[model samples]
Target: MMALVGPVGPVGIDQLGVYVPEYVLPLDQLAAARGVPVEKLHIGIGAQQMAVAPPWEDAVTLGANAAARAIAQGHISPDEIGLLLVATETGVDHAKPASIFLHELLGVTANCRTLELKHACYSGTAGVMIAADWIRSGAARGRKALVVATDIARYDLHSSAEFTQGAGAVAVVVSEQPRLLALDPISGVFASNVYDFWRPLDRREALVDGKFSVDCYLNALDGAVADYRNGHSTPSGALSEEFAALLYHTPFPKMAYKAHLRLIEGEWRAAGRNPADLGPAAEQSYRTLVEPTLGAARVVGNTYTASLYLCLAWLAEQQGRALEGRSLGLFSYGSGCCAEFFSGQCVAGSAKVAAGIGVADLLAARRTLTVDEYEAFGRDGAGADLPVESRANFCRFAGVREDKRLYERTGSLAQ
Candidate 1:
């Protein structure tokens, strides 16, 4: 990993795009089917629905769909993208990087550099930071980099993590003079050899120690935030007071809320104030600073590597013009476990660009699935019976043949 130092100029996300599967399994429906209380899913984990990808949609397809939207939204030509970095844990092939498929699907030039990054959920943040560094180093030579975080979160049926299953992708075009958020060059980072969560190659679903993962997450946040504050010596007020809002790597919506609470407790402890005395003020702060970021995640569930960026998309879509010139604190965490705390400022005209993205509209348009239908999707021999809708210009996985995985776009890229 490259050391994060101050950049020469502002370099960050120029445009953002997101793609969620059209199908969703409502948590209430899943809860009823499993004989679990609905509140445990709705209020406990703070998830309402989980997006479900059809068999034809893999990480590559989902990522391509998002990258296409971003390219269109940014008015970027394929030749202008000098680098393409894809972040995902749910990769389709063991040897080929997912970026190669995305490059073909998105019609990028052969000159572009492509790579795949994996660090559980933290890979997206790593991609963004690396892209920014590449621009600062003059490696892109005035060309932009496209970073896409895409994943399908799957778990064994009837397992503890079943309700968190979801599929989605988030893409951002990174360049100088960005129209969206401008990232601060310095980032606080931490890593450890803890195995709180992991997926072995033989298994299709991930194994997690839920309670241990939560503890690891909180510890990583503490370490990252401390390193961040060390670099930023603010005399005005508490470090938390410097940001308009805070966003965290959300495996689920409630996890973000917990991350915010941890920040509050850390600040209070540093000031020799009893964290128990935080009272209603901490709750109010969370409502003001964090609630908006969770709206999309509550509906989409855990997107793994896409999870953190998904929060940023939701915030930009919801807050719009209100975010102009304000600073935002962001934290990213990946289990096994790596973490980072960083800051970015909402650029001017961000609202206008954000308004054009249509993230909220995409969420509103999803179709709900019956519990039986959701279960059947995981069964073998179900793929042939599934109908593949031809979404214009969207890529779909056309089953493997002769050890070669096939892909096709529904509509022409030239169109």
Candidate 2:
């Protein structure tokens, strides 16, 4: 990993775009199907709905769609992108990097550097940091880099993680003069070798030590935040006073809320203040600074590598004009595990860029699926019985043939 030093100028997100699949599985339906109370899913798990990709949709299609949207929204020519990095855990191929497919799909220049990154959910933030460093180092002078986080979170049927399963992608364009959040080059990271979550090579879904995973998540957050504050000489109240919002890599909203509480209590204790005395105030601050960032993730569930960026897009879209000049604290974590605490300041006119992405419209336009329908969709992995031909105009995963993964692209370039 490259060292993170302060950049000479603002270098961060120039444009952003997100793609959630058209299908949605409501939590109420999931609870009903699982023979549980609706509140168990809605309140207990902190997920309201989950975005579900069809048999024909996977990381590649979702990523390509998001990248295309970012390129179009930024008015960036494909040839102007010098680096294309994809962060994903649910890659379609074991040996081939997903960014190679994305590069060809998006029509990026032949000279572009392309690769895929994996560190569980933290890979996306890693991609963003690397792209920013690449530009700041003047290696890609005058050219923009595309960083994408795409994933599908899946577990075995009727499992605790089932409610958290979701699929989506977020694409960001990075350049010197950013239209969205301008990143601080200095970041704090904490990594440890722990197996809270993992998937064996032969398994299709992840095996998680649920309680252990939660513990690791909170511990990682504490370590990262402490390191960040100490490295920067930040005071205890800096988190509560300086940052307008706090975003987390959410597997679910309730987990993020717990992490926020831990952060607040940690800050108070480190400052020699009684955490018990600050309970009500801390809760209020968490609601104010963190709740807004969860709106989208609550609806989309856990998107693995895409989770943190999804929170960022949600915050940008929800706060809009009010976000200008305000700083944001972001926490990125991957299970096995790596965590980073970083900050970014919203540049002027960031609201315009956020509004251009049309996330609200996309969510509104999604098709809600009944529990039976969702189950059926999940079972039909090969998409042989479905009318995939109707989706030919868009990028889709055509069924595998002769043990080879196939993709269909009707148009020359993604619209």
Candidate 3:
């Protein structure tokens, strides 16, 4: 079916805000507490740090922070946001959209259609694309929409997935003629494979055939990129070797590395040349952009769908370098399998993008516990589900007791 390709609608992200909890968790500390080899937490995975949010800050608070920060940075107004879409896997309620929480907590206008989208990590892009289409439809009429990606990943204690778990949120406002990064509508996606990964509600961690996941990712990546490149007759093909940078979802540092390598290998083979003969050019590009981005990912553990979005955020924050006015190829892969290959044109607004929280501050904020302590900390079970306290960070369910949750700021206001 031919979807409406609009009247040159210039839709893109207007502003971006980030929310990270004040707490930090050091992998070295985790090793110290677990009695595991320090290298396992260090060089092996190369993870130096992670963010740990208090029970009070769930997906909603994290999302709110990003949204508020975007506003604080002077981008859009609450009145301009006609739609609120929260794309997250770790939702507070299945029946109700978590977007409602942000709307109520932030006191968004009543007319906004608050909703949540779930499709693994692709949900964020889904939200953005939908907003883009809305703008293309002329339905926005200058109004904007809020798209938030917030997640808390926990893979149980001592599980493979555990090392990749991270908590944070990325909020972006989408509108017509954004001054920041301009998103190109051209995208390639692949659906219909469920064998790679999953985490059911009954289970706390995910079950992933690491190798299988990698294969699925590579296949989707190549197919989507090739199709897009072939369909559009652009210079050197978007999937060709020339682009500003390539960014990926770093579930575990090595995971994306393998996929990146596979891309190069396939490219060499397609040209009917020995991969070794391609020299360091191809390898270097992937190594420079893909590697460090994945390395930074190690500290985060896995954010399920939010992982790739954070990788992009991390890239935009690094200083003294230049990426403005360049095109970045992005591969966003989600388990239970969904993937997207798209490109984002980096504009001149990185000064704003840099304002987001950095790796150093986030890692520094965490409070480490012994592995036993971590197990105990996680086991603590949202801390005393009391109903009378006021919690400043207020989690999704259960009010604060005595100033903890029961006493949280209510929308009705006090008498």
Best by lDDT: 1
Give the TM-score of each candidate.
0.96, 0.95, 0.85
Backbone Cα, N, C clashes tallied per candidate: 0, 0, 25
- CA lDDT, candidate 1, residue 16: 91
Ten-residue segment with the worst summed lDDT in candidate 3? 406-415
lDDT of 2 by residue, 1-415 (tens): 9655554578999988888888899988888889889888778878899998877788898898888778877788999999999999989889999999888777788999999999999999999999999999888867899999999888888987788899899998999989998999888899999999998888878999999999999999988988888778874655877799999889989988888888888878878988889858877988899999998888988999989888898889878799999999999999999999999999999998888887777788888889888888778774545453343234666677887776666554435
TM-score computed on alpha carbons, candidate 3: 0.85
Worst 10 residues of 1 by lDDT: 381-390
* CA deviation > 4 Å runs, candidate 2: 1-8, 235-237, 383-394, 411-415
Model 3 C-alpha lDDT per residue in residues 1-415, reported as the tens digit of each score: 8665557456787776666665557777776655678777566655666666556557776787666666656445677888899988877655867788778765678988789988777788788888887877777766888899888776667765566567878887888777556787888777766777776777655667767877887787777667656556542332535556678766666667666777777676776778787678666866776765664476666665567767776776663047777777788777667777777777776555555535445445455645564565476655634334432332334555454332233322111
Two-way TM-score contest, 1 vs 2, winner: 1
Ranking by lDDT: 1, 2, 3
- Give per-model CA RMSD: 3.1, 3.0, 4.8
User: What's the C-alpha lDDT at position 40 in model 1?
Assistant: 95
Of models 1 and 3, which has the larger lDDT?
A: 1
Candidate 1 lands at a TM-score of 0.96
When sorted by TM-score, best at the front, the candidate numbers are 1, 2, 3
